[model samples]
Target chain A: MPIDRDDARRVAHLARIRVDEEDLPALASEFNAILGFIEQLREVDVRDVEPMTSVTPMRLKRREDRIAGGGIAEKVLANAPDAREGYFVVPKVVE
Target chain B: MDGLNSLSISEARDRLRVGEITSMELTQACLAAVEEAAALNAVVHPTPDLAHEQAKAADARLAAGQAPAMCGIPVGIKDLFCTEGVPSQAASGILAGFKPAYESTVTSRLFEAGAVMTGKLNMDEFAMGSSTETSVYGNTVNPWKSGDTELTPGGSSGGSAAAVAADLCLGATGTDTGGSIRQPAAFTGITGVKPTYGRVSRWGIIAFASSLDQAGPMTKSVRDAAIMLEAMSGHDPKDSTSADIPVPNFEGILTGEVRGKTVGIPKEYRMEGMPEAIDELWASGRSMLEDAGATLVDISLPHTKVALPAYYVVAPAEASSNLARYDGVRYGHRATLAQGDDITAMYERTRAEGFGDEVKRRVMIGTYVLSAGFYDAYYNHARKVRALIKKDFEDVFAEGVDAILTPATPSAAFPLGQKFDDPVQMYLNDVFTVTVNLAGLPGISVPAGLDPDGLPLGLQLIGKPWEEGELLDFALAIEDRAGFVAKPKRWW
Candidate 1:
């Protein structure tokens, strides 16, 4: 389906990426082109085929749920744009 | 022989053992080369002090006769691989000042094997674009060129390819997600291998599409690729998907013998509008493999046409989910917020300002596909088709095809900005390469021959899963038969 300007706006919002009002049409057209190209996938008969999540046939490796490797708070917050008293400081949502 | 930086990894290892050349000398030579080729914009972070320190350590190990094969070798680490305390931006604006406190598994393994790091190389933003033009550092120029037109080093591993081709480093690490490594290697006239999906650990490499991303080596020769790959690969407990298989001695077992191996030539890859040079190169590749006592069989990967579209859907869908972690809170470039702005506004502004156009397009597409209304039709359907694509490879390999041979790319390196305007045109660059990623198989692009414009073209050899040893051996055969010794003219 061809994506409209509203659809592009919705997608950008859903993606949490702010697209300018001017760029929405361009984004919509690009999405439409990609969706149009991807429409070709409907031609293949995928009846009874299982969706492949990974190339290998292995379950997610599980281990004992314990704190295995996270002690250095300084290292963890080394690249943080905003940190306060060894904790990441984000905008206050509850306020 | 020509210079310490020009020697292949194996040759450097030999010289290091025989006391002919020290690791410090080789690392210094590569550092000098990196300085001389600054115009190429290959090495993004030239860690001279760290490299010299590692080289000295390697020399000490070699003196004690305890050095591994990669001991003292100077290799360029792709920026995708996070080096502890070094900036590991996936060449994106959002990751502008982000530095990881932990090292990636692959680079850590390379470091453990005594490989000296020259610096982090440039790549496409989040390893998305094929031209490396989307990088914040700017487009890495292909060392090869026509009269005066500068060409692009195919990306997102463009910097890796350029550095190796220009002799800036002995070898460099590259991550292949939908032909990032192979296409760049072909463009720069070097050898690159994309190991099977689970071959290399992806612990610290910035995630692009977790299922499609695999790290490999870009080198001057297949033998060098083998040595580098061996050092870079092994199962890591951290990466749950990393294959728990024994790492084979890839360089030692390269006898260049492909006798009794059935090489498959897929009819589906013979796409229309393919340049005559690529076709000729493919034909010659078939002949060369046949001459190596391998039987060439016509095979069919019937679902090949849908691979690209499916890959686009799947890769972006996963990328959207993976990149969600890059919000303003934890790390990376956080957008300055206005008064009374909440977390959601911060996320929107941060992502809007951080990601490039191509990345935004992908994330939007990914979100659209995974949205409530279109999830089953787009993302789920694409995943099912991806299974069929994998089945197509499985069927051919089940029929005893040891490896599949095809053209690595549709054409040689194009001039920069020629295809930048059209994203579809740029996406076509990975047409011949994306199928391997979809099927989760190992693929290598070896410099086959030159095109009419005197640019290098590459032939791809796709191997069965977890069979990179055989894949590299067959690539060595092609490298031997093709005898591709041409290097890009030192324009930089």
Candidate 2:
């Protein structure tokens, strides 16, 4: 559970945020503070607490689940920076 | 047209129905006011031509004796909702040029009801942050408070709140996952309501947290909120989670019939640093309700202390998953690496350059909580706390309390960037407001009075499921007695 420089860097990289070398220390500190606060929750004894998913105790409504094929290919592709042929085109993955 | 800008939604609708004024004049007034307040940065996207076309159609319908429920009112669609041609971004760098192909059920329903879309108002990135300062588009200044100082129009929905408060638009659509609508409304001295979870459709709302997010009305008056909510609510086949319950005639429910109604005053909402002025004002609000023939009861929502923590976990976890679509290949502001580019690098680079610091911080926390080793420890535990918080409300409601009263926020609103360095303090902004979102219940923030610093404070009202009409009715009664001016005096 320790957040060293490498862990912070890897996390920053995974999150796609550019944390400069100096900023890494600050980000790490913040992460630690958040973790410290979260750790406090461990002290609470909720042995019998049921995991509540919503405020109202109503169950999730079910319907005949089916797919619409997104119904709007061009619409989905519209926001794609380099979209083509009713699809989002990205650089090839492997050689 | 009789100062259409000053009229409530009910008045406007009645006038339109009786042929007192055409839809064209009203829509034009809204558009003109938006133009006049261009300096407030309240509008992110404007479609004057489309709005004029829609208004003409509305007028034509009136001439032909066939008008939809909300005839010809110009409403500012919060940019968070996906409109057909109008671009929708959750006000983040990640989805700069994104436009949704499908319309959100709420937006589509309003359009169906004969409301004109003025344009998309600005918001905080992914509905994060209290001040709209986090938006990629610059901060939304409080349109009511005119000056070069650029005060904090409390946010995530600051733009919509500001627009409505300044009469840029008669009303605006606001989405509150956690305090997005109410906080901003309180700051701008307008009435903002966050309806029960399923009361409105979340389909195509550009998700923040799927479960907690719901859209509602931000308007100048309670009756306006009601009319707008009726038009916005209903069953949407597209959004299965949407409530199938019939939308009530919200205007029909606001008869000030709150005699003998029970309003709960939860002791937990009195946070440690809460201003004494808010404490006294809260007392005054309760007394006014009592004098109006409602019983004020002291209640305890014991689990309220845990609401902020549960909200932080649930909202971010969902946000992380939802925002994963912005990984370069899917949409918007792609960061292209030089040759030898791999897929992992592509995603990393794209997201790195796209999201702001606040978003990245959230994503990291979200990922951490939903990670393989931590899912149960963080996300599941938060769910347990979430249930407890819900139970607390249920217990109070079961004991004859019709609604809960508390301060909408810990303080009115601090200066912009006051708590930027401390994320915890920034998160604290939602201490009073987040519980409602956590519980998926209806809540509203009506401006009460100023704090010691002369900043506006809000009296929040929390209601049980599908009880928005009743809650708004009570709040509006309070407003009539409180004599709250819909527009702040200093508002430009």
Candidate 3:
């Protein structure tokens, strides 16, 4: 399966990464190359095989629904690029 | 160059226990060596103040007659492991100047064991590339040289391998998703162990491909790897994938006795056009194990050829999801917006400026594969193939095969820029090692011999799940037989 320039541009959008129009051709070609490599998996007979949910045989561990630990809002927001009044600031979305 | 910093972990431990040397002295020696070897670009963030503080604490522990094997030993922490108040950038511009508020579980354990932290070593950005060339800090040059050309230390654990090989640090931490640890170890003539999945806690290590990512040790020798790995392994409640199993005394079980053990030679790994030197090295490893009273049996892993392709799919898909937290709203780099750009534009521009070319390529591919109408065709299909790849190992192990032996890498270290432009060629470097990760089994790379160019090559040993003790024991056997004491001439 080959991806065209339009598909590449759409993928960059879906990934929330900006890809210029001029670079879409090169990106599409790179996608084609990788897709060509992975296309070999189509040949494997996976009729009755189950997709692996976990590598180990163990089930997901259950835990009590209690607060583990959280109170230092300053510590949690320490790395935030823009924090005001102990809240992360992002661009206005509902305008 | 024969200094305290060059001493192996076991050697340093013995010296520290007998009061022959202080942790402060060892830490100073390593700090000076890290300064001298600045050309290698191995230690990206040298934490001298923290190192001195840790050394003082370790010396106190040693004097109190309470010391573990790692007490007073100076080791490099790969930048992927977040250290509180220390820069833990995974060699990425996106994470430029990012410091975690808390300590990673692995580093915390090492510190609790009284291990001295020399510094944070370099790695591929987000552990993405095979060459460390993708590092925002720049390429970490391999201490080994081929002619006048500077070779890669082999990534994304390239800095870890280079630091250990160059004796800048006694041992260093490394994480292997797809041969990040083993490949670099082979390239630098050291020992690297990728313990069975769930063996080491991944609580604070920056995520790449969660299912496949595993933290291990890269050291000068197999015994040193054993000592370092035991200190690093255990269960953590923070990481649910962490196994709740007892970490065996890895160093104690390394008796170098493999009598009557059966080693499997996977027929599928003998890829066509493999460098003759690598093939010869594999043969020597086989004979060495046989000489140690182990029986050699030829086996077939029919899905070996698909491991690499499947890995590229699975790893990137997970990476695409794991890396989604790097939005402009929170930590790390946020692109300065243009006059009228909206929130979506903010995300697009920030990510565009943040990620490198290879990272962008992977993210795009991952998004394309996981998109509507293509999910079953690519992502789920790859998962089924991954199951088959895992079963291939299960079938072999069930038939009394104690371990499998193969070339650690397709070849020895190449010049830094040789395959930088060709992503496919670079991906081929992990051909022989990805099968172990896909199967979630323990695997190790022990420096076996040198190529015709006098570059070091490693032989890999694959073991049953959660059997790292046995794996390390077999690796010790190979290490003793090979006697791989050759070191690169120090030019750095």
In angstroms, how far off is B127's CA in candidate 2? 0.5
DockQ metric for all predictions: 0.84, 0.57, 0.85
Q: Per-residue lDDT of B1-492 in model 3, one digit per residue for the tens?
A: 488988999999999999999999999999999999999999999999999999999999999986999998999999999999999988877787788999999999999999989999999989998888999899999999988889999999999999999998899999999999999999999999999999999999999999999999999999999999999999998999999989999999888889999999999999899999999999999999989999999999999998888898899999999989888676888899888788999899989998999888888788878889998988998999999999999999999999999999999999999999989899999998898888899999999999999999999999999988888878998999998999989887
What are the per-residue Cα lDDT tens digits for candidate 2 across B1-492? 435755667778888988998888888888888787777788988989989999998988877876765878888998899887777878888788887777788888898888988899988888888888888898887754433455778888999998888877889999898899999998888889999988898888888889898899999888888889999999887776787788888888788668989999988887777778878878878987887889988899887777777777888888888888778887778886889877777888888888888888888877778877789998898888887778788888998899888888777766766776788887778888998988888999988776665567688999988988889878886787777764555445
Per-chain TM-score of chain A in candidate 1 equals: 0.88
- Write down the lDDT of every candidate, Cα atoms only: 0.92, 0.82, 0.92
Instruction: Indicate the residue-level lDDT of B203 in model 3.
Output: 97
List of clashing residue pairs for candidate 1: none
Q: Residue B160's C-alpha lDDT in candidate 3?
A: 96
lDDT of 1 at B73: 96
Query: What stretches of model 1 exceed 4 Å from their correct place?
Result: none
Candidate 1 lDDT by residue in tens digits, B221-339: 99999999999899898999998889899988888899999999999999898899999999999999989999999999999999989988999999999999989778899998999
Cα deviation in Å at residue B443, candidate 3? 0.5
On DockQ, the stronger of 2 and 3 is 3
